[model samples]
Target: MTTILVTGGTGTLGRLVTERLREGGHEVRVLSRKAEPYAVDLREGGPALDRAVEGVEAVVHCASTPRGGDERAARNLIGAARRAGVPHLVYISIVGVDRVPLGYYKAKHAVERLVEGSGLGWTVLRATQFHELVQQMLSTFARSPVMVLPAGVADQPIEVAEVADRLAGLAVRPPAGRVPDMGGPEVRTFPDLARAYLRATGRRRAVVSVPLAGKTYRAFRSGGHLAPEQAVGKGTFEEYLRR
Candidate 1:
């Protein structure tokens, strides 16, 4: 059994990754701001950060914040991993980070570069958006009688559990430089997805599409964030809503 450290181990995806690693008989350390034994904020890496990565065979970086600070967290983690001589560092990133113009995606792309050049054997898997995120978006819109969605935008929402499974498997394997992109079983437009959510939840709401103006929105409309060729995810959004 190997010792692995999973950053953001308590978050949606990270929590599952941590569980999977532990179930495989590996000693897993969960690093989060509030997690016990390793409650270190990665954004403010210090001695505690060093201790977290110490003696671990690999680190699966799943901790990220949409509000910001992702780049700083990644840098701190990379430094800690390097100091501890961690042999492998695996990172989860979005499929369109390099192509999209969103600030979050830019930070993700920057982190990807850091991981690539960290001098440690590394693996990076870029996946499409998760179902939970999509659900959250829809839920927010559902609060109102009218739902506004981006026009001409399609998303391939993958199952977060499946991603966790893949990350767990990668944590133990030899570092493979950027693996194939992972996507969902089908690509559905935003309006369609929103309608499906309404149907599943029995909520009556008028779904409206608005063409957002910006390079970021344009990139999304152009399907720069999609991975149709890599639609390997098993679960469908409708199936997810049913559950």
Candidate 2:
């Protein structure tokens, strides 16, 4: 069986990806900041990072932080993988990263570039936001008496497990540069999603829609982050909430 390395193996998406790979009978190496045997921080590449990549047939890069430092981590991972002679690198990115003006999206777009030009066989998959993230955001807003959401903004929140399954499938196949984008089954407005969350959790909060300013908000409002045409993900936000 081929040996594969999965960065951020403990995170939501990464953990699922690692499990899928292992189930497929591949040797999976998990690389994380606190994981045993390969407690590597990708932001700071070292011997440990190299060790994680050595002899691995492919690497699924699921490690990312929206707070910052993703570019650094990706650069370090690329260098280490190159040195280790890793043949394939797969990256997970967000939909509309190039269209949206958020700092996190910009960083993700930059990482996409790095993977494309890293001189190794690489594949990049851009997917819409995850249902968990949407739920978390709504939960944070629900803490306030009134939940404030962006006006006119729509989201297609996909299932993390579905994404992980796709990544596993990609890892086993040859690298395909920038595969088809993946999106959720339904495209719903922020207010709609928030209302669904409130109903699911039995929380009572008046969902307020505000016309947020700035290019990022405008981009979101214009549906830059949506993939209505690529709604290949089967899970819906309502279904996810019930589960």
Query: What do the candidate models score in CA lDDT, each in turn?
Result: 0.95, 0.95
Give the Cα error of residue 42 in candidate 2, in Å.
0.8
**How well is each residue in 1-243 modelled by candidate 1, as lDDT tens digits?**
999999999999999999999999999999999998999998899999999999999999999988999989999999989889999999999999999999999999999999999999999999999999999999998999899998899999999999999999999999999999999999999989998999999999999998889899999999999999999999999889988
Per-residue CA lDDT of model 2 for 51-95, tens digit only, reads 889999999999999889999999999999999899999999999
Candidate 1: C-alpha RMSD to true structure equals: 0.8
CA lDDT for candidate 1? 0.95
State the lDDT at 78 in candidate 1.
92
Query: What lDDT score goes with residue 66 in model 2?
Result: 87
Q: Model 2 — which ten-residue stretch has the worst lDDT?
A: 41-50
